[model samples]
Target: MPHQSTAPPTRFHRSIFARTVLWAIIIAAAITACLWLLTDATIRNTNQIALERAVDLDLAGMVDIHASGGREELARRIADRIALQPRDGQLAHYLLADTAGRRLAGDLRQWPGLHAGVSESGPIALPGGSAFARATQLGPDLRLLVAHEDHDIDALRRQVALVYVTGGLLATLAVALIGMTAAHRLRTRIERINAAFRHPDEEALARLEKGSLDRDEIDELTRHSSEALARLGRLAGAQRETTDQLAHEMRTPLMHLDNRLVKALAAAPEAETAARIADARLEIRHIVRMLESLLDIAASQARRGDRHGLAPVDLSALALRLGELYADSAEESGHTLKLAIAPDVMVEGEEMQLTRLITNLLDNAFKFVPVGGTVELRLAPGPSLTVCDDGPGVPLADREKIFDKFARGSEPGTQDGAGLGLALCRAIAERHQLEITLLPSTRGACFKVAPQARR
Candidate 1:
C-alpha cells in the first residue's frame, strides 16, 4: 500500500469558504445595523425639533391673544384655533386653567399630571400616545399649556426599523448566495491547479489555462508552474532517451561476447582452461543479466502510466503456475514453497512485466532465506500478492532504500548479483499503478504487492 498522511489538517486546510462566508455575514449584519441606528437617530432628532417649533408657534399665538384681551379672550381664541385646526397627522394640544386648577378653556380636559414648571420641557404621556408639553403662568390666577402629539413619529420609526431589518436580511441572503457561487468557482479553479501540481507533468500542465496580467496570483503561479513542468518534462525525456540507448546499444555486444566465450569454453582442452573460460562466460552472463534488468527497469519506468498494451491478466493462474515452477526448486533447496492464491483473481496489465515482478520478488526471497526456510505466496481478493520467507527479514533502516537500483539488503547472500531485482520489481509494479511494500515480519522478509492508495 502507498504511504498515507495520518496528520490532521491544520487551520489553513479547513473549509476557508465557510469561514469567509461567516465573516461576511457578520460584517454585513454589523454594517446594516449601524446604518439603521444612524438613520433612526436622525429621524427621531429632526422630527422632535420640527414638532417643538410648531408647538412654539401655537404657544405664541395663544399668549398674544391673552396679552391683548385678558383670559376670557385667550380662551375664546383657543376654541377658534381648535375649530380651524387642519386635519393633518400632526396634532397640537392646548390647555388653560385657573390658579385653582379649574379648566378655563382648551382641547385638553384637565391639567397633565406633571412637575410644576420643568415638566413642560419633556415628553408627557397622553391618553392614546405621548406629546411634548410646555406650561406658562399667564398671570396670578391663569395657566397655559402648549404641547405637540408625536405618537406618529414613534410609529414611523417602528415601521422604518422593520423595513431596515427586512432589507438587511434580504441583502445578507443575496450576499451569501453570491458569495457561495463565487467561492465554488474559486475552489474549482484552485483544485484544478492543485491537481496539476500533484501530477506536475507536461500533459497535466498544458490543460491549465494560461495566465495574463489581468488575472491574480493563482494564475501567475499556474503560468510559471507550466513553464517549470515543461522544463522538467524535457529533462526527463532526455534522461529516458539516454537510459534506453545505453541499455539497447550494449545488449548486442554483450550477447556477442557471451556467445564467443561459450564457444571458447567448449573448444578448451585442459580442466584449468575450461574452468577459467566457464568463469568468464558466467561473468559475461551476469553482466548480460544486469543489462537486461536495467533495460526492463528503464522501459517500465518510462511507460509508468501508459496502458497501451495492457490486457486482462488472470493473476490466479499466473501465481499458480509460478508457484508450481518454483516448488521443485524450493524442494531441491530443502525449502517449502506454499501457494495461497485465490481463484479467478485478475488485473489489467502486460503479462510479461507482471511475470517479471513476481519472479524478482521470489528470487529475492530465495536468495535471503536459509535452507529449509518456508516461502509463502498469497494472492487474495485485492489481486494482492505477498511473498513471505522465514529467512532474515530486511533491516529496519534498509526497507525504503532497498527499492532503489543497486541497493542491497543487510543480509548479503552469496549470489547477490547486480542488486537490480527489487528495483525492477518496483518499476514493473509502478507501471501497473501498483505499490510494492516491505511488510514487517517476525522471522523473514515479507514483500507485498498491491494497488497504490488514492491520495
Candidate 2:
C-alpha cells in the first residue's frame, strides 16, 4: 500500500476580512444614531425659541394698548383681529389670569399647571386639545397667556420628521457605498493571496508562459501561487523520475529472478533449494504488489478523471460468486459463510473494481473470523452489498484508521499482504460517489456499500 498523507484538525477561526467588516458596520451604526439624536434635539430647541419670541412680541403690543387707557377699546379690537385668523380645527386657547390664577376674559376654562419663569417651549396636549403656548406676567397682579392650536406645530413636526428620515436614508446609502468599495478592494487583494496556494500543474504552467501580471492583489497572489507550485512541481518531477527509473531497472531483474526460481524448483535436487525458491517467489510477489499499488495511485492521480465505461452490474450474482468461492475455505477452517442475495440487485460502476472491492472485504472477514464463526454476504436492491463476519469486531478507535492505506489491526509480519484492500475499496467507492460504512454488528465487522443511484 502507498503511504497516506493527512492533515491535523484545527479550531474554527474567523477571517480578518470578516472582523474588519463587522467593526465597520458597528462604527457606522453608532455614528448614524448620534447624528440623528443631535439633529432631532436642535430642531426642537430652535422651534421653541422662535415661538417664545413671537409670544413676547404680542404681549408687548397688548401692554402698550393698556397703558394708553385703551384697555376695553383695545381688548375689543385685538379680540376681533385674533378672531379674523382661521380657527377651524385649530387649537387656539387664550387665558388671562391673575397672580393667584383667576381666569379673566378668554376662552380657556382654567390655567395650565406650569412652573414660574418657564417660558420657551413647544406643543403640549390638554383636555381641550393640542396647543403651543407661552405665558408671562403682565403686571403686579395680572398674567397673560397666549397660545395657538397645534395645526402649525403639526406641519412643523411633519417637516422635522421628514428631515430626520431623509437624513437617515442618506446616511445608510453613503455607508452602503463605502462598504461596497472597501469590500471590493479587499476581495481583489485576497484573490491574489489565494492564487498563491494552488498547486503548480499543467494549467499553472500555461499561466506562467502567458507572462502577464496585472500588478494588483491578484498578481501578488499569482506570483506566490507560482512559487509554491514550482516547489511542488520540482518534488513531483523528481518522484516521477525515480519511479520510472525503478520500474525500468527492476522489472527485468524481477522477471529474471522469478524465472530462475521456477526453473530451479523444477530441477531442485534438495529440500533446501526448494525452500529457497519458495521464499524468493514470495518476496518477488510482495515487491510486485507494492509496485502495483504505487502505480495505481500515481495513474489515478495523473488521469484526473474517472473511468467512463459504466453499466448496470448485477450485485446479486457477484455476491453469490464470492459466497461460493469463500464457502469452502470458510468450512475448512470450521467457519460458516453464507450468501443472502436479494433478486435483481443492480448498481452502476466499474464491474472489475466493484468485484475486487467485494473480494477484499470477504478476504478480511475470513482472515479475522475465528473457527465456527459465521460470515454473511448480503446483496440487496436498495443499497447493493454488505459483508459481515462473526469475527472480533474492529474497535471504535481503529475503525476510521483501518481505512487508511497500509493500516491493519493484525500483528506485524503475520498478514499475507499489504493492507491496501480497504483503502482501494474506499477509493473506488468514492470515485462512484457511493457511501461505504462499517455498521455495528453482533460480535463482528459489518461493511455496507451504497451507490448514489440506489440511495
Candidate 3:
C-alpha cells in the first residue's frame, strides 16, 4: 500500500540534447546542398568553356588550310584529322560539310541543327554514347561540328555528388557524437544537483560548495540550491532547539500541577468535591500525555533531519516481541489478538523509534475496534507490516486528515484519545524513511507500513 513518487514522462524529440543535434544536422545538410550546386555549376561552365575553345581551334586550323590551298585542301585536311582520331569509346567528334550541305569528309554523316558560332546541341547518337555538341562554321558554306558525350559530363556530376554526400554524412556523425558527449556531461551535473536536494547531507552540501568562476548556468543553480538548503537546515535546527527548550520548561510545571491535583483529591472530604478534584487530575494527566507526544514528535523530526543513532535491527523479532506483549492486553479488552510474523527481516533504524512506531499502530487498532472483535498483526516479506481491526473503517473523507495532530474521525466523545497517536506513528515512520498507508479493506480498518527502500 506504499505510495510512489510520480514524475513526468520524457519524449526523445522533446529533449534539449536531441533538438540541438537535429538542428545541427539540418543546417549541415543545407550547407552541403548549396556547396554542391555551386561546384556543379562551376564544373559545367569550365567544361563548356574548354569545349568551345577546342572547337574554335579546330575551326581556325580548317580556315588556315582553306586559305592556303582552297576548299578542296580544307576538305582533305578535315578527312585526315578524322582518320587520325580514335573511334573506340571516343568522347569527341567532328564533322565538315560543303556550301550545298553535302558531306565532304569527316566523322559525322550530315550537318546537325546549329548556328555559325559555338552552340549547344544534344544526344547526336554516336558509336559509344549520346553527346552534348558544340558546333561552329569555318565559312558561310562550310560547317564544322565538335561534340562531347553526355556520359562524360554525367560521370563528373556523379563523382561530385558522391563526394558531397559522403562528406555530409561524416559531418553529421561528428556533430551527433559531440552533442552526445555534451549532453552526458550536462545530465551528470543535473543528477548531482538532484542528489544534493534528495540527500541534503554534509557530503552533498560540501560537493555543492566547490564552485568555479567559469561555471555555467547549472553551477549557478547548484549554488542557489545549496544556499537554500543551508538556510532550511539552520531554521530546522533553531526550531528543534526551541521545541526542546519549551518541552523541558513546561514539564516541571505540569508535573508540579499534577502533584498538587493529586494532593487536593486526597484531602477533599465531600463526595462532590472529591469528584471535581478527580476530574481536574484527569485533565492534568491528558495534558501531560499531550506534552509527551509533542516531545516525541519533535525528537523524531530532529532524528530525521540529522540521520543520527541509526543501526541495523531485526524488525521481525521486534514485531514478534511486541505482538506477544500486547496479546494479553487485547484479551483483557475483550478482543481477539492474532499474529502472523515472518522471521529475520532486518532494517536500518533506531530500535527505540521503530518500537514506538509499531506500538502506536497497534494501540490505535486496539483502541478503536469493538469489544469481542478481532485485531490482527501481520509481518511479511519486504519487511512489510499491517495492523487490521474488525471495527468501523475510517471514513474516506477523514483518511488523510487522521494523520494530522488532534484530528479524529470517530463520533465525538466515543474514544478516549487526544488524537496524537497516528500523527506520532507517521513522524516515527518518516524518521526511519518508511512509508505508512491506509489500505482498502472489506470489513474494517487496515493500515500498512513498510520501508521506502523496498518499494
TM-score of each: 0.69, 0.66, 0.71
Ranking by TM-score: 3, 1, 2
lDDT of each: 0.80, 0.67, 0.77
Question: Candidate 2's error at 257, in angstroms?
Answer: 1.5
lDDT of 1 by residue, 238-275 (tens): 98889878877887787788888778777866898888
RMSD, one per candidate, in order: 6.0, 7.4, 5.6
- Compose the digit string of candidate 2's lDDT tens values, residues 1-455: 11111112222244555456556766776777777678667867777676666666765666676678554654564566568766666445566667788876566767776542455445556666766777766567776677765346657666866776677667766776787677667754554344333323465445653433766655665565666667776876787788788886887799888998898888954998788779889999888877766665453343222333446677678778877888888888898988888976666556786777788888888888777888899887775578898777887667878877787775443356687778777776775556578887667899998854533
Which candidate leads the pack in TM-score? 3
Model 1, C-alpha of 66: deviation from truth (Å):
4.0
What lDDT is obtained when candidate 1 is compared to the true structure? 0.80
Pairs in clash, predicted candidate 2: 91-149, 192-221, 196-225, 334-372
Residue 420's lDDT in candidate 1:
92
Clashing pairs in 3: none
Q: Which residue segments of model 3 deviate by more than 4 Å?
A: 1-89, 95-120, 123-128, 134-145, 150-192, 212-219, 261-281, 295-328, 331-334, 337-354, 378-385, 396-400, 410-415, 426-437, 449-455
Candidate 3 clash figure, as a count: 0
**Model 2 misplaced regions, further than 4 Å:** 1-38, 89-93, 97-103, 114-128, 159-215, 230-234, 266-272, 294-357, 368-373, 377-386, 392-415, 418-442, 447-455
